[model samples]
Target: MSDPSAAGPTIDPMDTSAGNRFAPYSPENHSAPLWIVSILGLIYTIGVLSIRLFIKRRVFGWDDSLIVAGTLTGLVQAIVFFKALKSGLGQVPEHVPNLSTTASLAFTAQILLLIALYLAKCSGILLLRRLFVRDQQNTGRLCDVVLGFTVVCGIATVVMSSAGCPSTGSFTTHCSSTNTRWSVVTALDIATEVILLLLPAYLVWQLQMKTSYKLRVIAAFCFRILVIIFSIFHLIARIKYADTQPSPFNIVTTLVWHQTLLAWGLISATIPNLKAFLQSLSASWGGADWGYTVKAYGNGTFEMKSMGTQSRSHAMASTTGTENATDMDQKYETQIQTRQVGERSSLGSGGSQDMIIRKETVWTVVRS
Candidate 1:
């Protein structure tokens, strides 16, 4: 793969003399990777934005902010890799215009990739923390421990990758050693993902919800399992190219996987915040109030409740103190149970003693 002659007319292997061997630069080779990154970035941005718009109270939380930072770093990494490809990164060494410059750009790109991955992992963990760490549940302790472990692993992988090779010369001379270091980093990446996958499963398993609801929530969180699968694919690709010298194709494949990892991670983190949005969409299409309402109490607390619409109508009709009203209330009482309970503090500065009742009805039909 290092033979420039094998690359055809674009690269001239015969002119191996120092500084005269680089082929004419072309921008086309980078188009695929750039497009992949762009599409993934767009999808991730939409997911995060949807979270803010749909979940109202969850706008730009710690996890969302971290993901935004990660996305920016990922964009930088993609740009650097694109430039490196134009410098002949995947082609034969002699095809590169400036070997030193390519090496430096590759090094920078590698570091940025690591930083983006770290931020992505942390973002997912923070999201899990928000989802599962509320109240006095001891489950929060597990999330804390997993978060600490993820931080340690991310830092360790970055430090090892940076320090494993002192210079570009050493990197070329010790391809096997570099491969070994990357293997460790890949292992750490998979480990962190596994921890994240399990955290949500554990939380959902302990919830006292219906089996169907548990399964639905678990399915949403389980989307990150795709990230784990992608990580394994990346590791396999890295091993396959380990002996071939870092070429443009190898770097492109890595970038593709990296972008995929970022997209899936952001999507998984945003799933929990999408319930209200999905419910609203369903209600709009079905043309019925979905028995969901947002209400504010006098004590500066807000609650969202889901009740049966049919039961609500019957209760309204039976408002008068009559025997039929009493019977209807009892018959429909089972349908008014709370589906999900969330609390938020009011943004106003009114005294706690002030009695205020505010209600906002969000329409949607309840599906049994």
Candidate 2:
């Protein structure tokens, strides 16, 4: 559907509100940044779907939930962003578009969509926590806290988005600049973004695995942190513009860019997990059973076992023609026992040292 905001009257450039919050009502004000947000949103949506369908396993998992949420919000945001872009970029009409009705409905719809996006983001985080984190703490307790907080934030955002705007279906005024919703939403956003970043670090640290595996887990956490940083910057830009009247540029940056970052982070965070999901499918294709091996010689070797095997016979030189069968058997037994004892002692020492080093590395990374 076309944006309800597009049907408004074209406001001529003149002495007006400093920020011009209602300038978006005119079709002449949308600009490049808004369009860029729309484009990024579209890209994110397409990439998410393509990865989920073709690249990653479509199984029910944290990665799958995240991809779905990202794609859904990304697509919705693209639609709204496009509408915002078109409303601004279109040719100015001889008479102003009657934006009163449009703005009223658009404002209401925007509020609902914003709430939905918030929920989606929270759900994605919860899914990740479930899949990646294995702690001694009760999972249900963590989930309850997250869900309760998310619900509060979602309600707050919805209320604030509509608080200063005209009542539903009324076109008299567009959203107001003094509405506390803008600042409230921004604050909630920053808080949630920080929570998302910090929890993953804790989750990675608590994972029970080898040191190398733990590092991989931490890398995943770092990826999430980077996205949170991007989102924080996005929120900061919006918070700065919250009270300003919406210029074409400011509106695009405030509303559209913020949505894009939220969606983009959701998509980007799932990419690694999606990749892992895809790689797991390779196991079903009869690939070799591959793993690392430590030998008695203090060297680590990577190896794979396939389906074939062979046998070999060893010939021992006879020392005398009078050797009895019992004597020969005793000699073979002694040789086998000696070899086994030497191999076991070396392997035991090496294994113990490796375990110690692994524990030390794990503690260092996790504590940091």
Best by lDDT: 1
- Give the alpha carbon lDDT tens digit for every residue of 66-167 in model 1: 777877787787687667656666555545577667777777877887888788788878876665555535876777788789889989988888884644
True-structure lDDT of candidate 1: 0.60
Candidate lDDT values, in order: 0.60, 0.47
lDDT of candidate 1 at residue 92, scale 0 to 100: 52
Q: Considering summed lDDT, which 10 consecutive residues are worst modelled in model 1?
A: 351-360
Model 2, 233-331: lDDT tens digits are 656665665555433334445555555655555565554444334444553312211111122323333222221221101212233455344333332
The C-alpha stretches of model 1 lying farther than 4 A from their native spots are 1-59, 166-171, 174-176, 249-251, 283-343, 346-368
RMSD (CA, Å), each prediction: 9.9, 14.0
Stretches > 4 Å off in candidate 2: 1-29, 55-58, 62-70, 89-96, 101-109, 133-137, 167-180, 226-250, 277-368
Q: What's the lDDT for residue 201 in model 1?
A: 75
